[model samples]
Target chain A: MSGATSRATTARDAHRTAHVVGRVLGVGVSLGVLVIVVGLVLMLLRHPGYTTGQVPLHALIGRHARFPVGIEGLVRALRHGSAAGVVLLGVVVILASPIVGAIVAAGGFLAARDLRIGVIALVVVLILLVATVAL
Target chain B: MPITPLLFILVLVLVAAVAGLLGSLVGLGGGVIVVPVLTLVFHVDIRLAVGASLVTVIATSATGASRLLRRDLVHLRLALFLAVATTLGAITGALVSRHVPTRVLFVLFAAVLGYSAVAMLRRRPEAAPRAGHSDAVANALGLNASAPVGEGGQVVHFEVRRSILGLVAMYGAGVVSALLGIGSGALNVPTMDVLMGVPLKVASATSSFMIGLTAAASAAIYLSRGQIDPLIAAPIAIGVLGGATLGARLLTSVNAVVVQRLFIVVLAVVAIEMLQKGFA
Candidate 1:
């Protein structure tokens, strides 16, 4: 292939990968949102305070009363089928979406033989992981 | 402040959705609107509101950029390159926010925003080179890319120009975001689209992509601090995600000129509001 044709081919391949990555991101975020919605519905049903005009500032305190802390706590909550737990799980999933996208992009770049961007993607993943862990 | 529990939750979600829609349209994280609604209208604690707003911002970026990516409008390479400068700026801004006269900075930011609005409204050619080095630099970096134009199968290929300027603008955007607690999309879109010569659609998409990564940094801090309540963050995030998806789809159908006009309007409104608050 001529140089221009080769470049075009790479761009085309990159575009397809971009679409797939986009769909992956969308599905991950949508699932997170869906889980949260389910958790909210369950909370409404289980908590009498919601219907009773109580649980004032409910988001600020009432939910915090039984809040899950850290990644491990979120996993434990999801296992128990607790509403707040499920909601926390949603939050965790949503937070992880970009990190997952970055990692996938890194892999995709490597597969494409695009070393510079692949290295950059790996650096991005590292930054994200460090940020997540440091906090 | 004394509203019923269910009613408050419903209102919160609704308002967050509105914010997300408007934010995505203007390339913001929607926190600009969500923060005030939570703090002033709902009378939530400022810290709590900020935490919830940050999470909502992340949700807005994730959904908005995802759709843009699928549409092939996001310049992923450009976004990743700029992220380095933006992150550095964020750290610097956070360190200086407490010591600086933010009211003065607000005036300066509003001025920059006004200038961007003018640049956007002038209807200038978007692909023009900014300097002699622009084309050479872009070529060397392989920053040339393409996007699907309208309903046509044909594409418009363009190269990134004046990225030093874009990087500087991104750094400013990041600083403003960290300092003022507003999403930097207002600045990012114009910087990329107008200064760096990225197409408006691509610029907005890339801005959304950048916002996701930048917000994730502080968002982690806020969550780890136990500042975010699951109930508040969860519902606001759901609404933001939904609204941003709608906005992203709308973006594909809308003309580039119309999106630019709307972006200008958003910046003007945000600028005026910031100025008013600063003076008050």
Candidate 2:
């Protein structure tokens, strides 16, 4: 292929990758935010006093607060139908979006025949996964 | 004024919205505003504030990048390449954060931010170079790309230079981000714009794109450690996502110089705040 043609192909591939990755991020974030908003509304309905009572913000965020932590705790909260669990699930989804996006980008690069960047993206994904589990 | 828990969350959401707007425009994670307000105004614990801010940063980055990506502003290859360095650095920082004397690190970071602000002020905007003008490393990585500017469809094609240096700097930025519980966009932007020769707007957008992955690394650690409070993170995530979406829409049309000035102001403010924290 001519230089110009090759450049155009590269640009097209990059554009396609961006489009797919952008869709992933947008969809993930929108869904996560929607879930979080629903969870917040549920929390309000479950505890109407939250609107009138003098419960300080610290009651929820303070050291002694009893909220779920980690994936196992989040799953337990969800199983028990906890409103906070729904919110935590949303947070987890939000955090997971970028990781999903990176994975998609890696696949896109590999499909485009860009081995170097594809491998680099894969490495990044591995590092992120390791950070999640090991750190 | 005794605010109820609901009212307090409402107020916090509003504050986070503003932080998200500015942070998205400047490629930051909005922690500079969220952290201080959550700790000082809301009087939340610092750990929770940082945790919330970290989550907010991810929201900002995801929302901002989603929009910027469609506009062809984010350099995906460069972002992914840099993420490798930054993600590893973030884990290292998270591990070392417990052993490090945070006060000294805060002071050192403050100095770095202060210097970056001045450096940004002194540097003039760079014109996009012609295609095929990049170094061997950049060429091999295909880091050169064109970005559409304004509504006129005027595209600015720029070359990436000294990418190896930019990668090293990004590693340091990730460490700083993890150690300070802040988005390291203040460092990422300059490193890309100055060292790598990317245009300011593209640099900012790409930094925003990369910060999400970088923050996610440490945010996971925070999540597992029970530092992330759902009540706090939920509101922040929602507000920041909304604000970031709006900011990303505004970024492509706004003047680059205006964006740079806003970032400089943010940098100066964060530097001063870090200095105070170091002393306190």
Error of 2 at B48 (Å): 2.1
Per-residue accuracy of model 1 over B135-241 as CA lDDT, tens digit each: 55456446776666424535666667787877788887877665545567777887887678776767777888777777665555556656567877887887776
**Model 1 compared with the native: what TM-score?**
0.80
TM-score of each: 0.80, 0.87
In model 2, what is the error at residue B104, expressed in angstroms?
A: 4.9
Model 2 reproduces what portion of true contacts? 0.74
- In order, what fnat does every candidate score? 0.40, 0.74
**lDDT of all the models against the reference?**
0.68, 0.79
Candidate 2 lDDT: 0.79
iRMSD for every model: 3.9, 3.3
Tell how far residue B221 is off in model 1, in angstroms.
Answer: 1.8
* lDDT for position A77 in model 1: 72
TM-score of chain A of 1: 0.81
Computed on C-alphas against the true complex, the DockQ of each candidate is 0.39, 0.58
